[model samples]
Target chain A: MTFFINSVYFGMVLTFVAYEIGLFCKKKIRLAIVNPVVIASLIVGAVLVLGKIDYETYSESVQYITYFLTPATVCLAIPLYRQIHLLKKYPLAIMGGVFSGVLTAMVSIYFIALIFGLTHEQYITLLPKSITTAIGMGISEKMGGIVTLTVVAISVTGITGTLSAEFMLKLFRIKNPVAKGLAIGTCSHALGTTKAMEMGEVEGAMSSLAIVLTGILTVIGVSIFANFIG
Target chain B: MKYLKQLAIVLIVSLLAELMAYLIPLPVAASVYGLVLMLIGLITHIIPLRLVEDVGDFLVENMGIMFVPPTVGIIACVDELKQMWIPLLVAGIFTTFLIMIITGLVTQALIKKTGGES
Candidate 1:
């Protein structure tokens, strides 16, 4: 029993270490898709399951860190604050990019689900997968989703964005920070925003703005469409 | 005086936004409307940044603490999640990856067209 508690500590330590290693790999590997957070989280999650370390215990242990999501998100306003002038300069362009990006994410999921014949519950979960965890989970609840599934989906999407975004952008010949930021937030929400921040301020700011907007639009979009579907 | 006023405004604004969700014929709830309205206020200086400023820093510094109740919620779902494991897992993984690829593609194209700026 004692070993189990200690193992949870090791699990966390490994997660951070793996994340740092992923960061280092960026230079040597020259690959954008293999992000540190993704690699670390996956490695850690797998280890916990394999070790039979009890997910509940581990989560309880790290519950403190997860709570930081609110402040971390609110701090987004700091970056947005810096780029207020930039928004004024190209309101139309930014709005076009972000709204389109948000719609694309939501529609893509809905269409695919329709083709696959997903249940109403699954569709609800899909609705908020593109937004940040807090907002996504909140929306999922309103729409009658399984919050755990939504959270897991959200975390996975976020980690994927953090790890793969840069390389994907480059591979596809993407260079606009605003576009990059919008894509990141629209697809992955808060976790992706962290990586966006590392890229530069404009990317960070645009990503933050996208997070807030994506949540609003997605909620509105889902509710309206779900109404018609019913 | 300050916190009370801020709380009042948040409550009122959030309520109005919630009302809008019904009027606008959308699937989303009122908090979302409140969020958008709040952002607009901040953007236009209709609401001062000062109001949400301290709230943010405090929240960030304490993020890890907020995830407890939810994490516990996930734990309690062990049996239920297992029952629907296949679909949930498949949907979670499939949709996340799909959204990432397509959105990245579309945005990359848009950026190229927009001259990759602004």
Candidate 2:
């Protein structure tokens, strides 16, 4: 009973606190690493680890909240809706770029893991890392990979994308927001998108565009490869 | 009636995607199939934006919080994963990092060629 109550409170509190903290950090630190979700996730994850609380009890208590995930995913249409203009304006270019990027990202990692002699399950676990954390975690679970490992991987990749993106843009002299956004969303997923949005409207739209394209491309690429390997 | 349609579409997409996964043997799973399926519906106009606009709008705004339960999965499987820490750690970081770099570079090049916006 206590666990149930604690779990509910924990979820609610984490969301509120994390969002506020994240917003505050964004205003104060232009650096992108201070994202609310990342900050909150780390702190909350740490607390969970240290709490000695059972995950089952906690999840069961807060399952009501978690169920919102599916609907939440469907909600991505909002941003896409706003950016339909971007899609309309540069449909061919955006799709072509994003699809190719998605292909390169997934195949490159899949092969590297393959060469590393990682098991099938391990490969599946990391397959969705370039996607958002929610989707990535779910795919990881289904593919028989560690969900926690996948989440952590998602966060790290997001942070890496957020932190290193500017350096990357400058290093490679990538000037276009669409290119930058698509690149980040394809490689880093949500975290990268967050940073891309911070850079500008064009970057944000392009990043959002990349998310859709890469998600589709990766799906196709993964399916094709799954056939060849199996 | 409206909510039911929304939920049903989500389910249909999930099943269709999963079926595709089974037949295609992709490393990815069915739910992801569901995501791609929806994306296609939007792209090809199989499902009009109005049909899912409200529901999809809701899903995106709250996408951040979706990982809570799954992250909670950490506690459930930590024991099994703990035993394989080295492999999981190495594979997780290396594969993720490699994908990030390659995807970033490739997408950058693609955008340049596509010639839309800078």
Candidate 3:
């Protein structure tokens, strides 16, 4: 029992268990707000605190899990491949929306951080908060931002995106499936894509395309913005 | 055995991407490098779609589960995060809506102008 508790199995098991609980809650509530990542992290986090488990120990035990993040990101290409025809269909419209969305996400975060009196470090940390984990982590690290802070910010950003996107769509009267998918995926990454998937297959595929395009655009946007700022 | 082969293909592509990122002076993420490389390979038929379809689908479909552990890292900096909770929450919530509305509206208009489906 002690051996199982100390091994990588411990963290992996804990994560899976917590995630299952999250899924259960989502099914019960039928609310997008009940995001599995949020629920799992909160449950697992509280458990770690209550049990006196250090973050370092927990992360170390789950280190292999983190390694999968890279390959998982690579797998994102498959969806984009399957839906490449979408790119061919509406190249200009897709690029216009994705580029604009990526810029708005970062720029708004920067201005908001400034208006709210956040330090430059905090601003940088929040820069890539809307992108997927793999690309977001890479952008944050490359731009001298804190990975932990970016991860947390991304989670919050994702949760917010997931929960409020539908309302925003109605409020803005966005009726186009392509536009809806592009907006959600561009603004909130994969988490928003889940909601988009619920909307329809075309929405889901378009959102998947936006997720990859937004990531690529955001990386370039951050690099160019960094140069300008420096 | 099939799963292992698929995993190997992904890892190898990721490895090559890592090498590319190292050799290049740009700060592009290795994952992006890998993604682009895999994308080109697929488009060119150099890498068959079936080769990694199962593994790829499984990974992307369950990608959110992978983010949980890293996000739990926030526990270590709760105090520091607490100091800026208002700004953090406000910024996160506000920007999400802002981006969604703006992106959605702009795309909607453009698509309308282009004479596309709703």
Give DockQ per model, in order: 0.20, 0.27, 0.58
lDDT of 1 by residue, A1-230 (tens): 56756664654555456556656776678666655555555555666667666667767666545544443554566567767776765566666766776666667666756765777887777667777776677778877887778876666566666666776767665576766777777777767777787788888778777787778777778776555333
DockQ of 2: 0.27
Decide which is better by lDDT, 1 or 2: 1
Candidates ranked, most accurate by lDDT first = 3, 1, 2
Q: By descending DockQ, how would the candidates be arranged?
A: 3, 2, 1
Better of 2 and 3 by lDDT: 3
**Candidate 1 deviant stretches above 4 angstroms:** A1-30, A228-230, B1-118
Clash number for model 2? 11
Q: TM-scores of the first chain across all predictions?
A: 0.88, 0.78, 0.85
Error of 1 at A106 (Å): 2.4
Q: Candidate 2: where are CA atoms >4 Å away?
A: A1-7, A133-152, A227-230, B1-76, B83-101
Q: What is the lDDT of residue A5 in candidate 1?
A: 66
Q: Locate the minimum summed-lDDT window of 10 residues in model 2 chain A.
A: A69-78
Encode model 3's per-residue lDDT on B61-99: one tens digit a residue: 777787788778878878777767776777678888888
Cα displacement (angstroms), candidate 1, residue A13, comes to 4.9
